[model samples]
Target: MASKRKTSALLAVGLVAGIVSPIAPLAVAQQLTTQSTAVTHTCELVKPWGLLGAKNQGTIVSPETVVVRYPATVAPGEVFTAYVQPGAAAMRTTDGRQAGLLSYDIAFPSNSTNLAANYNGGGSGYSIPGNGPALVDRVAANGQLATEGPFARISGGATAFHGANSRNGDAVDRWKAGMQVASNTTFRFPEVALKMRAPVSLANGSTITTALKAAGQSGDSDDPTRNTIQGAEEGGWGTERTNYYFCGSSANAGSLSTTTVNSSLPRYLAKTTTRMVTSDTLLPLAARTTNLTAEVSSTEELMSNIRPGGMNFTIRHKATGQLLATVPNVTVGANGQATASYTFPTLSNGSYRDEYEVTATYAGRVDDIESSTSEPVTVSVGYNEVNANVVLTSTNGALSGGTMPVTLRAAFALPAGKPAPAGLAIQLFRNDLPHGAPITIPTGTTTANYTFPTDTLTQAQETRTYRYRAEVVPVISGVDRFVGGSATPVAAIVVGSSPGSPLPEGGQGSVALEGFFRAPQLVWDWLTGSIGQAGAFSSGFAEN
Candidate 1:
């Protein structure tokens, strides 16, 4: 009981450390002798120094098996032995009598020798029997009975190592029994050699995946169990066979890697929509907002498995290459898409030349290493310039049959949030053509002064309601930005008056007639005065 408990503890420790060896069953013919047991032992296979480069561990796909080849140079006929001694249990004979003795077993397959000798060795191959209860049996008059036998010769090249020893006949068993000896015997045992077998199959349709571990450990693989020394098997009490053990480094096998490939199709399709809120209350220069929406999807599947919360959007100024805004951690809707909105900076009431672009990138999750970026979507920002009429006035008075003085006043319509225009230039036209070169003027710089005067008009040529017009263009920092506008045409009458016959009146009649005639001259003077003051003209004629 105590011995079994100790072995159980060791087994538990091995399992906890991930050092699991194959568990082979005892030979079917090897049974207890219904008597007392004796000293027990254990043994393990060791890789010889010559085969240090051999493969010890690996993994394979289903249907394929793991085949651990032995050192090619090793041959048959060389006896392999395991010396046994009293472990947790004291030595006892088959007759239930305590015996101060030890047990031993030897194996020597005839495959190498017999195959060369007769071109066949049957099923007699090498194998380490599975661990079990003490092999001690009823004590014969000659010695303790043996419980393990050697491989038997049949009619094949070599037999596959079986879970149990062969049971051809008692002759082979007797020979195997004779091979066992007491610890005091003079028989010599060869150096331990690694024991391996044919490819091991897992199941009918099963795959095997071995997770390689970080190396540099002493007992990572099926490391040999050593109680006996390496060279000549010097000082050791017993041996423990490592059943169904793999014997090499897994690092030398292979490696795991991954490659990333980009596709022409975007992981998410993005579209941007932009518009200005043109309300009476809102400033003409109010900032415009743009909404960006991206549809997340996978070309491999009908419906995209991509969800929300792992995506971000970047809005950039396409013209200036500036980053406008960044929207992160956006959630996708049930329709497999996400949306974000950003408003551009407020600008003056005028068309803008700048445009914005948006792009979305997906952050990958578990089991899926593929990530995608949406193609850039563009949104143009613009505004309508407020058109203003140019006003035409006179320096002296409305044009008449004599020389007339004229001045042109132009008002620029700047957007709400835009900077003031740098300057202004005006052109007066008698009839749409450059009115005798452009009149010198300053515009945009300030709100106070934005006007120019034309040269005093010379004597009229054919006076037929002389028409006048003006054009005003805004200058921004030496650049002509807004389109110029034309003022409404105005006409001046150049009529002639005939002298009235001498008044045939006397006394008050003559005086009243003189006052009435003087009224026209006064009215003409008043019209000129009103023109100079920028007052509206009631009618084209002089009034009382």
Candidate 2:
């Protein structure tokens, strides 16, 4: 009983430091012969799961099988999920003694790129000869219980080196089985799975290998892995097999192949600069062409020389959040500069000012660079310019059928060679509200004229002056855009010579009227004065 107690004590002490070479001291080779009645043997059987097969069967486990599998090629910053598996166990005892899987230790390659981010242990498939049931056994890693329907999760997902072993920096598993093995003449062990994760760095070629340690330590005898199995080999002894089957000597034969990081896969950095080439908001019917300039460059050398048609520009309506167009395949020049343009449709909403937000994307070359998109930018589409004068064909300030003719001229600041538009129309407003029928600008002409009858103008009891403004309306099939001061109030008709309230919405998305929350006292300021002081409405209105 004293000798039996000593052997059991030593066994526990050895396996704790991670499975290694010669965990127990041979000097005290367990004087078991004097204490136990069971017979013993020095010969051993190498589990058939190993590659040596029958060649190593009769000998004390001389060949080991530790295999590794994972993706051989990985880019920088990619997470590598790798698997390390030790050989299955095949042990036998003529006297009805049992021995099988419990725990083992594994190590990762020592490299700067390998990180200890994730370590998971699990597996399935096993056959219990004594119990006659197909069972599943696995190492529970990172504080998880094994799914074997037992409490076998000893201590896995552990990274402590435990000792002076160079590979311990990534040690995982000091795990144990939940149930003791049942007596059997021969028992089959279960397959195990250990997974680890690390990110690849900026290396041209990095080697990722996982190695398994062995129990057959010391150069004194090859049969050391044998240990005269007196039933104590069932993990009763400190020197235990991962499967308690005398897991032979280990070799570094199974390791992952080299992983290569491509040059353009995840290497180069990129930037895209945007500039509004047209300078200001386009005037309605003023050649709906909105021009833009893009500077697309990369941090890598000679990237500016990339061929044309690699960039795309996306334009979206700010008011309605609708996709207008994607100008595809523009080319960047030697200076990392490119150009893009979009012809906008008429703004559909008359009350809201419309702007086109643009974003540029660089479709990098598959063989050399990666793709990227630029920050977004916006430019107002249209805010028309109107100059008006009133002409009366009847008595002045006439309330009856007197004809009031107003000549409307269309003009805009367009690029050279770009013609001022035709096919556009203007709508008149009587004091902030839409008033008359829309007038169209005939093709081949830049001017539109409309005369209104007197009865259309309504009056209140007090002597009042009616403020009138003509706004360019969307008559084309596409976008109709605008900004604050819907249309400058050009003329006023006096009924009794009394003026009304100050117009706050004159420069809508342009500025802050001049002071206090509402449109400032200078509500009638021209477009310049209108824009600078009213940044308050930029989100909904603005002028070039």
Candidate 3:
């Protein structure tokens, strides 16, 4: 009795972690912020033998009471507990990033008789007499315990144990960490009852289970209230028994009840827009810009689950179905919108006719299911005007019979490897004014050709000069295509000298010298003025 009093003072506690390495305590409190769903159930064992009498037949065996508690929000370094009355197996928790192992801490008061010490092989059981509290660091195999310091080994031992025989293997399932009896009056327990923390990478909504049970049980029950305790359960304990020679027919415990307080489900929609953007005044080889924007919102306005880094978009060329770009990190604004901008390579001179599209997808957090892709937005790319050059050259430098031959060359200036411009018209200008009706020219494989009629310019009785050049007329609007260009202006002079007029110098002649040279000199001066005007006109046109 004296040794038995000392054994009553000690208690046992336990816990577990699945990983080979132990979990470290967290420095800061990292809560999940979401409400945790509770999982609870009950179990019981009874006897059917009426010879044992009512009190012994229907004994409320196993754990008389059981309660498992979980933190509202589990985080790194946080702790939870489970309460078992007298007998049971083990408890479990939902598996998540924050949940890894089950750490059990049991305290046995000194001189307390709540615990029973049983020896191996159904030997006589005894209680320790008055003695100071003693803690045994042990590893359990089957229902037997061996002394080993706490936290000395990785936690992956069996959770249910038989009192004397090694009832491991299939007997104990679905649980980790268990204990065995060392002596009739003493117990070997884990030095530290701690469940290693889970890896931080585990996502929200992950679940884990913790359970408790006795090592073995008899096949027969004496309780009239229930018979299945010792019998097999479909989809449950199966044919496994929970009975040991020292502790015969250990009973199963009661279950836990929980009512859901709220419901959590995420739903939203996403959309995007793509457009070709250009300057108001288009230029040749201008860069093309495609602006993409995405918007996301929950179908129910009451809930808002969009996070900052929860959206993305993709751009593609429609004609070739080629992917142009993908933007993965789009920050969602308070208004539930995100945007991306991309500039295409500069385009060469030609009729650009291509299409592009953009699509968006939401990258939600845990519990927030990813949203479907947004509707594709399409835009077209093409030129509104033609890019070509026109040049005018005189066939003859001098004018006779009040006529001069001039040629107009219209050539499309396009980037290398590009097809020539088609369907072009040219308008010639002389002396800074329209010289004649617009002339339509047929396009060659490369250049368009046109000829100015002879006598197109008439010289006065004296000598004069004429300035000529061709230009592209404005015909296209509300669209962008080829860029417009012009050629350098050229000039021709006509010197008028009658056959009757005699040239004289240093000596007298039939005609006066001054009168003879005066007309031609004046004509020459007028020609110079026309040349100047042509230059000024070309520069001014280019500026506009």
Query: Backbone collision count in every prediction?
Result: 14, 22, 67
Instruction: Give lDDT tens digits, candidate 1, residues 240-274.
Output: 11111111212311111111111211121211222
Every model: Cα RMSD to truth: 29.3, 24.1, 22.2
lDDT of 2 by residue, 323-424 (tens): 888988888766666677667776566633367777777766543344567777776655533322222121223333322222223232222332225655
Q: How accurate locally is residue 281 in candidate 2, as Cα lDDT from 0 to 100?
A: 48
Candidate number with greatest lDDT: 2
lDDT of each: 0.31, 0.36, 0.34
Q: Rank the candidates by TM-score, best first.
A: 3, 2, 1
Top candidate by TM-score? 3
Predicted candidate 1, C-alpha RMSD: 29.3
lDDT per residue (tens digit) for residues 1-544 in model 3:
0000011111111123433222332234222121111222223322122223211111122332333232223332122222211222221112110110111222221111111121111111111223212222232323234432111121123222222222222233222123322111221222222222222233444332222222133222222122112111101132121221112222222122111111121111121222222222232234456555667665212113345435677778776788978878777667677666666544435545455676778665432223546777664555444465554544443334555444444444444433343554567777788777766544333455566554345544443446666676544323434344455565554433443322222221222435433546433433554232333312111000
